[model samples]
Target: MKSLVFRVFAVFTLVLVAAVSGCGQKGPVLNVYNWGDYIDESVLHDFEKKYNIRVNYDTFATNEDMYVKIKAGGSTYDVLFPSDYMIKRMIDEDMLEKLDFNNIPNYKYINDSFKNLEYDPNNEYSVPYMWGTVGILYNKKMVQEKPDSWGILWDKRYAKQILMMDSQRDSIGITLKYLGYSMNTKNPKELEEAKQALIKQKPLVLAYVVDEVKDKMIAGEAALAVVWSGDAIYCMRENPDLDYVIPKEGSNLWFDAMVIPKGTKRKKEAELFINYMCETDVAFRNTDYIGYSSPHTEAVKKLPAEIRNSRTAYPTEEDMANCEIFAHLGSMLKEFDRIWTEIKSN
Candidate 1:
């Protein structure tokens, strides 16, 4: 998710009534790792100013990249922002610490609908942050016909004008969905089919990009792109010519959440930071600034009606019925990696 927020009409009524209290004494730097360009940088500035606890904020481009760095035993990250399936994988591997919900009192503001997700069924190790769907973002001027199916991505006319995600999980997962297979398919044959499908479509794709896809789409540089809904919102505001859709074939409904690592020495401080992030104003700032869907009930209520009701950001339940939350792949992830490498190289 990235920023260039909505018109949001004029000013919203969201307010933070009380100033946060400073940590009594200086503590070790709170090492936080999150997705690149996914948050409002000013939030970190404010959190720092409030707590007097220095934050060493860093970012990763993908979940796999972050997992590898954290799993290798050299890096010391205290808090991580990982998507649903990756969070499950980290928990299974014992890489995450069980969150002490008592410290996250603001958790009460989180929507019940977003709670108890399969990836964190018990809600023990992770806290929901931003959620969104994967869909097609296209320039309305360039695409005259309805871009309602993933199959359009393969249409010959759109060749050299389509952007696919650079991430292995997303690009491969959508291809699996397009082929009537589970995105978490552990079946070798099903995965092979998705792999072949992507290889065939490679010639049609203009580029494999992540965040850059947003800028390119906003500038009307591409006819279509596989993008996160949050990015689609940002692009739509910048270029009304841009629009988004969850294809008829269905797609991934994803959640990115916060979790502390297993070996953090500053656990309580990390909890404080997490609670602070969930505060109404902070949550609203992050959601508005980044254009992502916040799980915080109060924060969402504070959003302008346009954003609150935007079909792109919040699809109807019936439309969402076919969508799936990604599941931890375990050993099958290696197969996904192999398929992705071949797709990119082929």
Candidate 2:
């Protein structure tokens, strides 16, 4: 028995040493870019330990920023986490690699509903990471009445106490919805209305922010804020006085998914990391820490019952019936950019 154990250990040591020495080369390093504060991060170290690959992780604040960097053409990133519309744009531009699903067998664990999404109808270029809705996250103690409409944000009573998203798509898209238009509308007239509405409300807005919305809302610095459902969950947990509501008018339903860039030499290594991320245990750790909704069926089963069943985390179809998924705006996007600049400058 002692001889057998010693022999097995010797063989393992020889194979491990040969893996790095045989090629006179070091292990691969994969560059991954994703949203800030979006992952558990510890999982990256875990993946490194398990696969003998080093990860170089960086973060971007918004999808547009990410798109600009990658579009400028020097990024060495192997993996990315971009929202739906951006993914569609990347696919159309031939910026992404067609994923070989065979390398990511764990793809089967993702919920069927999250598959064949509008952006990747054939599931060709991306894997669903986290999904959620956009809504009003407000402090119950600061408001005289519950906020159920986006119109409430313009109330003079809440002037200088309302936080709005800094992102062009979310702020303007929500306004478009509030004005009884589609969040993805390309009509210049509708966009003008949305722009004017935002300009009108700008004086009431305390600030246009992103991640700071969570900290501000938690500290009671603002009475109300526009936030993603995941951020709302995190804020609500820290300060129970906070509550989130999907407006009666409508809102955008959005998600960020993982994809590989077309030029990556580390394609296999990238796929390995993606597969590792989808492992039930790894997926559970990410969602649990990030306060985001996981599309992994097995990981969803592992979440705490309270969060797993919370309507905020997983809204029923009726609640989301009116929600629109943003599509790639193409030239119409320039109109949005112009409007966003005007609103901010005003």
Candidate 3:
């Protein structure tokens, strides 16, 4: 009897020890992939310290690069920051996981206008990170009058003094908008028109670039350029003469969202991170650090009056209504790429 009792006690002790050891061990970590210099680094560090989980971050210059890498299964990333159109494509490819909203309590702080967007109509798969427009940013000192039209980029006066984003989407989309066609237009005729317009303007530009446009524009290397609102904001800080404007014709309205990638083992942690970013205070911190607009309504309310009222950040209702949010163009993207390559090579 005593031997049987000893055996039972020994087995129970081993089971308890195994369970406790498992409980103490950490789970798989999070891998975050995002745009370069798009977020505040401190927020990431604080998240790591608070959660006791390691976060590995990576960056891509363009969404196409990110899509290609992710689709190739080159790396396993727990989270990705993608713009609206890319999110649509990712969803169609089943690359993103459906978010567990209950875990993201701070989501309620997001502006209602930002929710139910065409890309994530139900908001089941992504959370808004930053929202802005693609517009003209110019050095006022070089131009006697502010540029309110896309044609300013093609003006003979600004020749060799213009910089344009190297991105296929922004460059093509803006030309399409300038031509009075939908940025998401798949119409061959409209696309051809946009292509011709770009070719005409190509000789006038200093260079097609993404990063350092702010610095170049501020240093007076370029007098006018098409730039993202966030980048425009950065330029304004260095040179007060810098001005951002949504062309009277229109511009692309872009929203980048944080999403959990499929196959992530840290779903709970990923959800927590999203919620943490959505919190009013945290959202404000990110906007302050990144100099972009926050989509959280409560956070927007707390921003400085000058920032909250900046027409460039939050355009008037009429201007907002005129702007079209980019939609996934499917196969039309290939056509754009071919033309873009030809344009750049020439």
Candidate 4:
């Protein structure tokens, strides 16, 4: 009887030890949501190795798609990459958590110019990741005249050879600029005019595209396409005949920033991840891989001379004097959506 009791006790102790060891081997997890093809994902692996924490990375094609998923709220995300205007909307809706910058010392590397922007005025909720101007990407061989203004998108000469962004904000914003209205204008008259302009131009547009813009432009599928600066840089690399220009009338100056959402269960871990991303070496790797404008001042210095000097990648103040950053539209978003549906249907 004593021997049987001893064997039972020994087996129970061993089972308890094994369970504890298994628990110890498991690490914390962080969920990151970002735009498609926006990051050098190798950084995620390096982060996991360095911290012994697993990263669950996900991507969305647009800000709206990300917003919809996050708003639906079944899953939890520690970190998110949202553009300036969307950041404002999220903040207004109380969807983001205030970041404790004390853990993010590497934020010192961010350019002062990129800080204290309209979207996150106090720098409490977000960190600027990448920024650039929206512009027209055109094929030099196909475009006989120099494409300098947004007016060219309306020209009949390029009809059926033009590609527009599928995004409502981008398509409408540029049309607003072409009509001499603010990109962030809330006036119904201005918005209607912009909508009508798009409806009229739809017949000329070859297609409305998103990520496919890079592939299409590279293959010479379209003569002219509205493109983000980073995609323009990537396309220019693949096709020498490609050139990017911010219309003379001006364009949207956009920024994508990292933020912690309200549902984050691991605030400290998220802060650590943001700090790691702000590290100079990591920022350099991302900029080199993604071809977007880095807000990290130190990382910009590490880029090649041509990229550092490229007007398409880094536009000068004179180039951006008339440009404006997008602002949150609040209830007006519904109006924009309604118009967009009309444009697409027509």
RMSD each, Å: 12.0, 9.4, 7.8, 5.7
Ranking by lDDT: 4, 2, 1, 3
RMSD of 3: 7.8
- For model 4, residues 23-128, the per-residue Cα lDDT tens digits are 6467998899998888999999999999998898999988989999999999789999999999999999999999999999999999998999998898899999
TM-score of each: 0.88, 0.89, 0.88, 0.90
Q: Per-residue lDDT of 235-343 in model 1, one digit per residue for the tens?
A: 8999999889998778999999999999999999999999999999999999999899999989989999999999898788866777899998787778888888887
- Greater-lDDT candidate between 2 and 4: 4
Our tally of clashes for model 1 stands at 0
Q: Rate the local accuracy (lDDT) of all candidates.
A: 0.89, 0.92, 0.87, 0.93
Query: How many collisions per candidate?
Result: 0, 0, 0, 0
**Tens digits of lDDT, candidate 3, 223-267:** 888898888888888889889999988988989999988888789
Superposition error at 239 for model 1 (Å): 1.0
**Which parts of model 1 have CA positions greater than 4 angstroms off?**
1-25
Residue 181, model 3, lDDT: 83
Total backbone clashes of model 2? 0
- Of the candidates numbered 2 and 4, which has the greater TM-score value? 4
lDDT of 2 by residue, 1-346 (tens): 9999999999999999998566545688899999999999999999989999988899998898999999998888999999999999999999999998999999999999999989999999999999999999989999989888899999999999999999999999999999999999988899999999999999999999987898899999999999999989988999999998899888899889999998999999999889999999999999999889999999999989999888889888877878988999999878889999999898
User: Comparing candidate 1 with candidate 3, which one achieves the higher TM-score?
Assistant: 3
Assess the local accuracy of residue 24 in candidate 4 as a C-alpha lDDT between 0 and 100.
Answer: 44
Query: Which candidate's lDDT is highest?
Result: 4
